[model samples]
Target: MHSERASLGLQIAAIGGLLFLHLPILLIFLYAFTVEERTYQFPPPGLTTEWFAVAWNRADIWPPLYLSLKVAAVSTVLALVLGTLVAGAMARSRFFGREQISLLIILPIALPGVITGMSLRSAFAIMEIPFSVWTIILGHATFCIVIVYNNAVARMRRLSGGLMEASADLGANAFQTFRYVLLPNLGSALLAGCMLAFALSFDEVIVTTFTAGQQSTLPIWMLNELVRPRQRPVTNVVAIVVFAVTFVPILLAYYLTRGGSETAGGGK
Candidate 1:
């Protein structure tokens, strides 16, 4: 009875914590449809879709959105490929500095985003590298790699090695075995990792602030709109669009992985 009570209390606490953390986001969504000019107004006065139409009509928003989407797509692909290679090497082989390699893979994500941004900025300055969309892509890839690496490593660990051995014994070459055996097992994790990386890159602002010059990604555009005097309500509309855009990809990724797991189980 004591343990059950404790567990029940813990569940309540967790729910409370989640609500607290998400309160601001909830408010953003709530106010997106608010008719009031200011957010501080009580009960939002009324609700309207004017700001949504305003946001849609704004020409300035599209450029940043396009840049962000392009960079995110490129960065996520790079992260997936590099992360999978790193994960494969670390998980499947024993070598020198293996522990160090793992640590390096995780280090960028563990450090504060500001610190990562600052370091990248300094590196670019020293190398005389110009800030552009490519720079943003590179900056985003640093932490994005960690997400992919983690997913790949976890899935690789869970996968059976006997299959690889069996493939080898059956005269399959390394590339053939990897294609037919390992790739199939890694599909779900890779898809999940790509979605996560894309989401991270899409909304990333801190590192982007340092690396981007003259180019504004969607988040950067949103930040500017937030600080600007006019179009305040329009910012909320952009926020709602961002939430929708990101949420769909995330949901698709979730369902894909779930489906993959079910298929894997059925095969078993």
Candidate 2:
């Protein structure tokens, strides 16, 4: 009886935890369909899909959305290239202060978003760099690179050095070996990292705020809408769109990285 009660209590606690975390997200979805345009009623007065059309028709929404997509695409590409190169160097080479360098590479992500934002803002101000879409991309790439680097380095460490040596013995040139052997091995990890980076960059508000100047990304636009809502349900509809955009990539990344550690260098 005690064991049964304990198990029931544990299950109840787990359910409570999940509800606590996800209940607000559920509310956002529910309110997206609400007919009431300005206020959130306890049980929505009526539900309709009209807000979807409202949000879609809003001229202000598209520009920020387009900017966010562009920034995320550019940032993810930059992160993948730079992070992979840094990961390869760290994984394959031993040099003085390597650990310190690795820590520095990851430091921007470990810092608070506000701190990172402020630092980037300050750097841009000092350099007299005009804030534009490129500024947002640069701010996002700082942390995005860390995500890719972490994923890539973890995969690289799991890779067997022997595979590279074997490719060389088989008369594969450096470029050929990398294209054939390393690329295949690193593909999933790099994809996972890029997906994660893109998702993060898309939803990022803090750093984008500091770097964006007169521009607004989707998240920044959402924040502004929340502050001065013209139609509350329309904001919720946009929130749903943002949630879907970020959630899908995160879900895909999770699947890609699942069992990732069990790879080519399992014995090693």
lDDT of each: 0.83, 0.88
30-131 per-residue lDDT for model 1 (tens digits): 777888775557578888878888888999989999998999999999999999999999877899899998889878878888988999899999999989
TM-scores of the models, in the order given:
0.89, 0.93
lDDT of 2 by residue, 1-268 (tens): 5454557889999999999998889999999888888777879999899989878899999999999999999999999999999999998899999989988887887778899999989999899999888888888998888888878888888999999999999999999999999999999989988888898899999888899999989999999988998899989989989999989987787788787663211110
RMSD of each: 4.3, 4.0
How accurate locally is residue 208 in candidate 2, as Cα lDDT from 0 to 100?
A: 83
Model 1 pairs in collision: none
- The candidate scoring highest on TM-score is 2
In angstroms, how far off is 70's CA in candidate 2?
0.2
lDDT of 2: 0.88
What is the overall TM-score of model 2 with all chains considered together?
0.93
